[model samples]
Target: SQQGEEDPQALSIQEGENATMNCSYKTSINNLQWYRQNSGRGLVHLILIRSNEREKHSGRLRVTLDTSKKSSSLLITASRAADTASYFCATDAYTSGTYKYIFGTGTRLKVLA
Candidate 1:
């Protein structure tokens, strides 16, 4: 599979703290996108940075891409309890037509109040 795998299946942090997670994939990709899923909620798009880009930030979240190494990292600063959720990395292999994103197994993050 051309999917990525995230380290540390789960994480716990206090409110107003920071959280970091890493992902590694097997295939080359055009872009990578980060998503958040709160419990039973749908996945919400967080940010997406293309292969040519090294880093991108959205609000309190920051994402770094290293295409040469087939790896990516996500950093959330000053995390709040509300930030508790599962985070996933989805990648599109720069393919045409039928190809879709392959999502990582995800990292479950718990932010303590």
Candidate 2:
């Protein structure tokens, strides 16, 4: 599949702790993006890193990409209970002469108050 794979399908942590999620893809991609989805709601874009970018930060979120390894990671610092949600990594890949956006399985995170 062209979609990426995220490690640690589920995670539980206390508020103020950090949550880290890793994603690994199989093929070349133009860019990678992270998203968060609350229960029964649509996904919200968190960050996007191009293939040329190595690292990026936005507020409490940190993202790193390693094209050599075809891997990426998302780190949420000082996580709060409101951060409980499922995270997904998406990539735009060229497939069958067309570019398609594929999403990873996902990582479910639960933050305790």
Candidate 3:
């Protein structure tokens, strides 16, 4: 079941400026991941921040997880028009020795040229 909510719901940013969005969840998770979906196509995994880790970075993408606050944030630096997409946060939970990914409502990001 999806138990997370992404703030802003929609965002618009100019090229070169960084974009930041947040995801807040309920329940314990083994890991939290950020993904980008272009026009509802398959998702492209952006970053995964484990419960034990506070922050991680890949290329121009940065993710931060605050388990204490049950929230996570994704930051994209130097954005481009291609970066425009819907971003989702999925919580990985383990139960009965099986792992399940619960995705939250996405944040629509429009990167203008």
TM-score for all models, in order of appearance: 0.93, 0.93, 0.96
What is the C-alpha lDDT profile of model 2 across 1-113, one tens digit per residue? 64789988999999999999999998888999999999958999999999999999999999999999999999999999999999999999786999778999999999999
Tens digit of per-residue lDDT, candidate 1, span 16-100: 8999998999888889999999996899999999999999999999999999899999999999988999999999854566668
lDDT of prediction 3: 0.93
Model 3, span 1-113: residue lDDT tens:
67889987999999999999999999988899999999988999888889999999999999999999999999999999999999999998787999989999999999999
Best by lDDT: 2
Q: What is the lDDT of residue 34 in candidate 2?
A: 97
Please list the residue runs of candidate 2 whose C-alpha ends up more than 4 Å from where it truly belongs after superposition. 95-98
Better model by TM-score: candidate 2 vs candidate 3: 3
Superior candidate under lDDT, 2 versus 3: 2
**Of the candidates numbered 1 and 2, which has the greater lDDT value?**
2
With a 3 Å backbone cut-off (N, CA, C), the pairs that clash in candidate 1 are: none
Sort the candidates on lDDT, descending order: 2, 3, 1
Using TM-score, give the best candidate's number: 3
